[model samples]
Target: MTSRANRSRNNRCATALLVATTLVLAACKAQAPTPQPEPATPQVTADTSAQPARSTDAPLPSEDASLAPAVTTPALPSAFVDKVWKVSKSGAVEPGTTYVFLADGTLVIDSPNGTPMHGRWSFDKGALVMVEEGISYPTEIIAIDDSQFHIRSHNPGEPVDIELVPAPDQPLPKP
Candidate 1:
């Protein structure tokens, strides 16, 4: 009878030890996950009413040699390259204003004042992104062809539809 009692006590102690071990293992495994960095928010100014000062001789966006290899600029479509397009109709840009998109991703906006506005241009995420004087405008390309290009501004209040026709003398870039 004493041996039976000792066996029962030993079994209880073994079960308690197993349970304690399992609890300790579970506590160690249940850790808070490491935090991840947030995505960068683009810096945009609120003064959308004022026109940015044109800088014809402005240097291109600086490219660091070390970072250039990792950073790849999405190429503009071949059909839109090296062409001078004029605004046939638009509320954003003055009608008859010419915009030249060079193959090297340089955008030349011939302002109504006749001063050329130089800026960097790139096609990103299915939108044509134009950055001028630190302001970035991502406009949706409605359609494009050898003859005409249509674009819609992302502005909510003053939404603009710009129609662009190729310059008479300028021809489409060779594929």
Candidate 2:
């Protein structure tokens, strides 16, 4: 009777050991080596939703860069790069918002999806203003640059400053 009980106990111990070994093996297989990224390339397309592509034509992260500076102001219209900019923490762009600008002093921004906000943009004598449609007052453009801008209203409220940055997979400037 003693021998029979000892044999049953040994069987249970062996089964527990087997289960533990199996669990250890599974854990080892769960971890995998991470893959490395390839070399950087150049020549990316213009996209506002994503960052610029990795390319040789693009500037490196260590390169000296500035979004906007006090000096070296650029002229409007010609300097503005027409693209779909993501409105971060700004007022609604309205439904079906389509921004169209012509070189001949004609500008239109319409909302196609929701209520439309109509406004005409014009720059003169180093001043910028948007008026008409539903806006109560004119919106003044304080300053604009490659990656940042400042806009203020005539009524003396907090000036809204925005930074325009390249989206991921965006087109990089030609080197």
lDDT of 1 by residue, 4-90 (tens): 999999999999999999999998896788898899899987542222222547543454344222112222367666888989988
Off by over 4 Å in 1: 1-76, 155-157, 170-175
Q: Which residues of candidate 2, in runs, are more than 4 Å off?
A: 1-71, 81-84, 91-100, 110-117, 134-139, 155-175
Best by TM-score: 1
lDDT of each: 0.68, 0.47
Q: What TM-score do all the candidates reach, one by one?
A: 0.50, 0.37
Best by lDDT: 1
| Clash counts for all predictions | 0, 20
